[model samples]
Target: MADIAAASHMSLATVDRVLNRRKGVSSRTIERVLKAAVELGYLNPEAHEQLAAPRPPNIVFLLPMGTNPYLRLLGEKVRAVADAHSRDQPPIRCFFIDSFDAKALAAGIRQHARWADGIAFMGIDHPLVREAIEEVGASGTRLVTIVSDLPHPARETYIGLDNQVAGRTAAYLLGRFCGGRKGSVALVAGSRTYRAHSERETGFLSLIEELQPGIEVIGMREGHDDRNENYQHALALIEQHPDLVGIYNVGGSSDGIARALTQKQKSGDIVFIGHGLTHDTRRLLIEGTMDAVINSDPDQVISATLAHFNGVAQASTRNHHLQHLKIELILRENIPLQYV
Candidate 1:
């Protein structure tokens, strides 16, 4: 203590306060004491590095406001992660917006960008939204896309599954599950404005035509990821197609479809595939209503976002690998015990 006080040109009392991380010590004094400690070999290198690290930036996550169980789970995970790292990491705030309204979404981005050093969102592919992202980028705020992506070059990175691959996987699973029996399939989407949903639909259709020609896609309907709406859409599809053997949902609200199938007495009869693994989907899987679920880990998504903001080398590597998340296929047999 005395040596550090002498080296830093301060009293023993000030050195004690700085070492103990007490109140009333200016940042400049703290730095002086830390530097003195480093030169005198009183502080370990790792400790010094940690103490000298820059203050974490403020970041915001813009999520969609909806009834989608998967999206709800994602928001919860984000809050939990932010709370857990409150001391050493960037302060994270989340805002739920009307994702379908392009103008509102654009406005939300611009508003949040005013105060946040970094912003991440579930991007909608709209001209206004793209323009907003570009404008925000021009203002020097870093941006990232989560779950969905935009074509704008301003986005720093994207963190989510490869939707096209997920779509093809769904097609393969449905075709194989149908046992080559000739029948038609119906597709349900939350919204085509989300590039993820559009990509998944495109991949599903292409693969079904190339490999499962016997299975025809009758039509697609937008349910906006709402349970009641998706339920109506599913029922309508069942009524319209007597030979429906498969249904692939490129978005959320799998429970609505499951309920519709149950009401129509076709739960186990039709091969059903969807995205996101939630409690409702898990129950459906156990009850033989849903065949398979394609998902990406929400925890991993949050971790990768934090890594990008922190700018640590190891975390940067993690962020690079996590740009395209690994798709997880969950079935009735392989459902994790924790989720159950």
Candidate 2:
């Protein structure tokens, strides 16, 4: 019973309810327990023979390979959760491909469609990607877009926050923090290939124009979420616009921005806002290098993906349905205690 519980990643009480066929236990939970029991050879041979062999669900998570700690955390959590539930054979696999390469991502989808029961990925909005998603759907494989969404209508679900709202939130925070100061601002993104980043820039620029007329947006640059690239962009912004009062990073590698600010002696002078919360950002926030961080929980996103595979989160959150994740605004004083 303990082994079965462990394999199912469920509490002993929950396992008991499932094995005993209790009323409160959901069918999904019961199936998971029974499958674990059978895989562990805990079920009686005669009883096991009466039921068909358990065919574990196959789930593949395709994530971007980059220096972004947030994506790293996501991969770690997915692996941990997958390990917890795995018995003789694992059901989940995470594949990392080149960042911002639409062809590579689309190829991954097409390749995984052959074997994966479900595929979830941080999608890029592109014609080739949409074609691949549609092809995968037609092949009867479930597909979900995570973090960043694709423009395709074939994706089974999208699991992430409303990025436009997050952008607007950043604009509101930066505007309020600026206190009606007239100055130029700059925006940096990993890549506009990501719909989330583009959406964020749109909402941010729109709100800034409406609420803070004095603040001029210098322009946006593609940093590709690289430390050196973003650092260079920061330097260029400082050099071109000496009066640049603020910067909003729509993607990762915010530490690069911090370093640039420190070098220019404008760490606190320039109002800086970025996305994601890692150790680097935590320290920056405490040191006043960053004024705000708009974040989405990677753990929650992974959990939602897993729940979808388990048929636990499918009723309400289905195909093309947006499970708008919680968007958090972190300040130095209100930094979350849990780093990971």
Candidate 3:
């Protein structure tokens, strides 16, 4: 405690408050203590063991099942992490729910309450889903929203990017890359039902309007994160807007947009900004089909969620604020050599 306090430039009492998850301490102070403790080996296995005996909390990851590579990758990552810690940690079960269906997601959440100690999912922003989560929480099941969030206090934690900021970042990159070209830009998303997509669209549109008033947002379309669907949407947008200068894909299935742009002979001519750093996006970035990729680490998100439910003391001290997760901007040269 003394070493952590000294390293964090805080008193021992403040460190104690943060470590013990006591109220009345500022989040900033808690972050400092977490950083110091993690650096000083206080958040290691020994520390975890000292905090409490490993209690395997039964956690379920309700993920989207579809052709979207990003969602698939997220599910794979969750499974991988769960497998790695299966013997020592909680039994993490992944339930693949239908994509963009609020009623189905709510049903899944409610049905799993009997078997799960906690539930985490990429929820659609709907009243039914919100009420389901609230009911599950009331049932003593910890609720976590992954990759997107519901209204405040609906879930215990949200594990994903600040989609609004991600959208604004995409807009900034797309707008600037357009070189002040006077033309309309298209926006593609999995579905506005995903809070993340809607937030990104809102942020992107707001910034484009504020910074580049001349540039018109052609329209926002839901592609359901399906390659064929996104391809059709992008093709329609291209055909509708002969003066299209750029495109921002706030959700999955960017490969469809790339294909559409290539077919339309606008691959390099039109600036493309997208989300995720999957195999397709990586190739697109390298081949110049994609200009920039706004990436959020699925592994980190899973790790954080697991730690949160595991009663890990360090998780309490670490930052859990919305938008605190790192939003990496990847270009061709700066792209990681490995895609997984």
The most accurate candidate by lDDT is 1
Question: In model 2, which runs have C-alpha deviations exceeding 4 angstroms?
Answer: 1-54, 88-90, 312-318
Show the lowest summed lDDT stretch of 10 residues, model 3: 312-321
lDDT of 3 by residue, 1-340 (tens): 9999999999999888677654345556666787789889889756644333434567899988888888888888888876777355678889898888889999999998877878888878888898898887776677778788875464767878988899999889987898888899989989888889999999998799877888988789889999999999889988989999999998898999999999989889989999988999999998999999999877778888887877634333433345347998999999987673
lDDT of 2 by residue, 207-295 (tens): 99888999999889999999899999999999899889999999999999899999999998999999998888899999999999888
- Residue ranges of candidate 3 with Cα displaced over 4 Å: 1-54, 312-323
Candidate 3: C-alpha lDDT: 0.83
Q: Identify the runs in model 1 with alpha carbons over 4 angstroms from their true place.
A: 1-53, 312-322
Ranking of candidates on TM-score, top first: 2, 1, 3
Candidate 1 overall lDDT versus native = 0.86
lDDT of 2: 0.85
Better of 1 and 2 by lDDT: 1
Candidate scoring better on TM-score of 2 and 3: 2
- What lDDT does each candidate get? 0.86, 0.85, 0.83
